[model samples]
Target: MFTEKGTLPDGIEYDGTLHSGYEIREQLVGDAISVFDDADVTARAVKNPQYLSVCVLANMLVSLGSIPKDKITGDLLMSMSQDNFNELRAAEERLDAKRKSFRAENKK
Candidate 1:
């Protein structure tokens, strides 16, 4: 995993890691979605698509200050300050873009 360090609004340093698109898909489908019933998941997806981003962030975030990776959950992310949450979302986007660029340059 490739990790980049960033600072939160509160100045807490964290590491965000890049994940492959297939790994993200597996996280969403094989873990996040599979944990819930299909109908329930579908309703939640329709009502709160933003949660999918939370899941992806939780999956990619490697560390936050002293916080353990396993302790980083969607609820924990949601509980963060809006500025912090937005920073994290932006970090995820940056990491995703980097991963895509790397894949594009490496493709045979």
Candidate 2:
């Protein structure tokens, strides 16, 4: 299931933290099953370059407060379908609202 669809650009390379894209996808599953930390969560996504889509991954992470828009790559994101992209965006918005409400209460 693990295959290299392309090569990393000469100037760009990723740290080897996962054995397979499946590993990265599986990590995303874990994120849903296990509660994420209150802090940023994007560094924890599945880093697959093929079957796994980064846009879907980044948005999911954003929903969890794992990554901000600045952390995601637009090139990779372009590969994701509109439906999945929308879901992630919706999740991000919902979570952002949740966070804001929590913060607002603390000031009261």
Candidate 3:
């Protein structure tokens, strides 16, 4: 399972057990707004069949290609809460602020 806070670039390394040459992926990710928008447009086209008549299938940029009508159930994802993201950002800020000191100071 992935962590809610593991939404950083380079956060994922290789999954040693699963595959060979570094099976890395973004641990957690943001919503695909474009995908959502395309799905919506396709949904509308589907509802009003007359609309498709105008385009004559000229534009699939919205869908990026053919969309599987049956597979789309309109399920979307949750965005990170401002409070939680801010907290993580603050923690990162604090760590960065102390980075120079941490690196320069001699460990006794």
Candidate 4:
């Protein structure tokens, strides 16, 4: 696991530790394919764009300040202020880019 820390605009600190790359890929693919029993619902959910980002962030976020990982959810994240949510998204993007760069360099 790789962990990165940052503070949200609301002064809440977050841990964005990610699971293994393989696990993330599998989970995302599985969620995309099976989020709903009905194909129509799944298709609609997937088409939202924010749906995937929310799912990914929910999985990657280990904690918010004193909050435990198990208590974090997409609904909780969605309920945050727009600035906080955007900050979280930015943090996730930064961590993801860093991870990708590290992997690319290591493959050389």
Estimated TM-score for each candidate: 0.59, 0.35, 0.25, 0.60
lDDT of each: 0.57, 0.37, 0.31, 0.57
Sort order, TM-score high to low: 4, 1, 2, 3
Superposed Cα deviation of residue 94, candidate 1 (Å): 1.5
Q: Write the per-residue lDDT of candidate 2 for residues 1-108, one digit (tens) a residue.
A: 111122112212123221111111112454343323322233343343332344344434432223233444434355445654555445445555666676788885
Q: How close is candidate 2 to the true structure, as a TM-score?
A: 0.35
Candidate 3 lDDT over 34-76, as tens digits, reads: 3325766567657765443222211211221123323222220
Query: Which digits, one per residue and each the tens of the lDDT, describe model 1 over residues 1-108?
Result: 445557777433335542221111112344465424456545655678686566556666666666666666565666666877777666656666777888999999
Off by over 4 Å in 2: 1-72
Error of 3 at 105 (Å): 1.8
Model 2's alpha-carbon lDDT is: 0.37
- Window of ten residues with lowest summed lDDT in model 1: 18-27
Can you list the residue pairs that collide in candidate 3?
Answer: none
